[model samples]
Target: MGEVDPAFVQELEHRPKQGIIEAEGLPIIDLSILSSSDATPDHSQALEGLVKQVGNACRDWGFFQVINHRVSMEKREKIFNASGKFFAQPLEEKNKIRRDEKRVLGYYDAEHTKNVRDCVKKLT
Candidate 1:
């Protein structure tokens, strides 16, 4: 089939659902129990507390981050730099190796299509 008009896609009708109800605020978890000179003599107590907090957050907000993970600072920096570089590229360059076609490699639009593939090819 030929290219589909984006406007048409956007206008396609769909079933309606009940509106979401806004909630008050997130529940607070006490993390102070995780730190001390002689607290429990092992990380088990701290870990248990964290697990409970994570479970609550997951149920209430659907997401959260762990602060004490052992990933190196250097690796985190590299990830941030790489993500920024990818987003900063010209639109044409990004579409050249679209993600859908390459599957495991190449850049593509957020929806995964190869449309404007020009800028990056010219750079290299």
Candidate 2:
């Protein structure tokens, strides 16, 4: 193919305007209840309560977080930092592990080749 034109590439990269909306929302539930020394009779009870709450949140709103879990503070902080760094990397670098290279693993943008049903089945 002939050499691509730089101006054409720049135009392709341009983004269109988006509408904005302001909305009020309720505060998230306080998770400190899971952390207190007197929170539950034992770890098993605490875990059971958390599982029920998480299941309800998943079914109702599709998202939740479990605070005061076994993951150490240092490990969680490290994971957060590492994820931020990975996301901040240049697109070229991230694309090295793009999803089509495997049935699983790496980045899969919305335009990924695999069908949604197949991907979900494989993931599950």
lDDT of each: 0.57, 0.55
lDDT of 1 at 110: 47
Q: List the residue pairs that clash in candidate 2.
A: none
Off by over 4 Å in 2: 1-50, 111-124
**What is the Cα-based TM-score of model 2?**
0.47
lDDT of 2 by residue, 2-112 (tens): 995443343322322232112322213335555666754686686677667767666544455455456787997798779778867998988888887445778655542
Q: Which predicted model would earn the best TM-score?
A: 2
What's model 2's overall lDDT?
0.55
Clashing pairs in 1: 93-120
Model 1: weakest 10-residue lDDT segment is 115-124
Question: Which whole-number lDDT from 0 to 100 does residue 72 have in model 1?
Answer: 81
In model 1, which regions exceed 4 Å deviation? 1-59, 101-124
Q: Name the best candidate (by lDDT).
A: 1
